[model samples]
Target: MKEIQHRSDCPIAFSLDYLGDKWVLLILRDLIFTSKSSYGDFLNSNEKIATNILADRLKLLEANGFIKSSVSPEKKNKFIYNLTEKGIDLIPVIVELMIWGSKYDSYDVKDVVKKLGKDKEGTIRQLREKLSARINSDVPSNE
Candidate 1:
């Protein structure tokens, strides 16, 4: 990973230095919520991200230890992307973003927000556990 120069010691600035781009968050959103794992799948998302941007974001995500890529077992030519533990730890951040957006954005997210009502912490815990289990199981053992 390349050394990133932080403008300040503040944590928010540090985080934004790596993840300030809209594309980065959106890609993370797809990984966390959807079953997207391939280059084509990301390209096909509704955001219509440019190929160059998608390629760049994927590389950056991988370089930053947030994601890992492996060749598909069934399809030798295809690659599958999975979240690392570091990435899994960001689930709560993503969920908080969702909650914030639902409240402020014009789009109707009432259904989703209603589902998350009053138990935000519990919801975060459940999502973390589920995703952690899935990610751990997907990793190959050294033994």
Candidate 2:
């Protein structure tokens, strides 16, 4: 079967072309807000992303320069995935979604509120620094 194509010229459509899936955004949300960086953490999410789907998203996200994965210091068998500069730049998107969720999705997220309260811009700035500092750019590290 042929894959369906999105023909809209809007940038949102373009973005969605790569990351429009429901699971991708949530995974991103968790990474940014929860500082989650490992496989087990993502697997343990309340969203309960399926293992095969999670693996697929991780590979795609990495290919698109959205995230990078590295060996965990505490667990050699596990990988700790970190968002790249491109990924960190998604803070505003996450902020907007969280706000939308609180307003419409009916979840009480004190974490997001607190994050925004304590210097929203500064928080995003710091997040950017953290993500950019360790970008792997799909380049194989000399491990």
Candidate 3:
């Protein structure tokens, strides 16, 4: 397989290259919670991403192997996209964002925020465990 080049050696910088934009993470947040797919579904998200930007980000995400797209068997013209394990590994980032935003932004995630604040490492460990368990179940044990 061909190697993929990261923008920088720093872990944060490299991660930013993958999910730096606001729209990318917003889209990911939707995917994680709603399992939404297709152009129309994305356009209808709470953040209201523009059609063109969503298209571009989805393409970039696919190229980077964060997601995979397949045709909808139910509809000839529809498409569906699903997260890869690499993408689902972002739960910690989302959880951290939840904590930070809950602090400074005063969002309504108090319950989760309280949980994270109470035990940050424990929260991360549990989140990672859940993600891993989902991966183990969703994907075959030996793939």
Over 1-143, each residue of candidate 1 has an lDDT whose tens digit, in order, gives 34467899999998998788899899998888778878899999999999998988888888888888877777778777878889989988888888888878998776546667778787778767876776777544212
Per-candidate local distance difference test: 0.81, 0.75, 0.72
lDDT of 2 by residue, 1-143 (tens): 12326769888888887767898898898888786777778899999999988888887777777888877666678887888777887878888777667666666667756677678787777766766665634534423
TM-score of each: 0.86, 0.80, 0.72
Q: How do these models rank on lDDT, best leading?
A: 1, 2, 3
- How much does each candidate deviate from the true structure in C-alpha RMSD? 2.7, 3.6, 4.8
Candidate 1, overall lDDT? 0.81
Which stretches in model 3 have alpha-carbon errors above 4 Å?
A: 1-7, 110-143
lDDT of 3: 0.72
What is the alpha-carbon lDDT of model 2 when measured against the actual structure? 0.75
Model 2 pairs in collision: none
The collision pairs in model 3 are: none
Looking at model 3, residue 14 earns an lDDT score of: 89
Cα lDDT of model 3 by residue, 72-139, tens digit: 66776766776678877787788778667777885566665787788978876775665455445433
Cα deviation at 115, candidate 2, in Å, is: 3.5
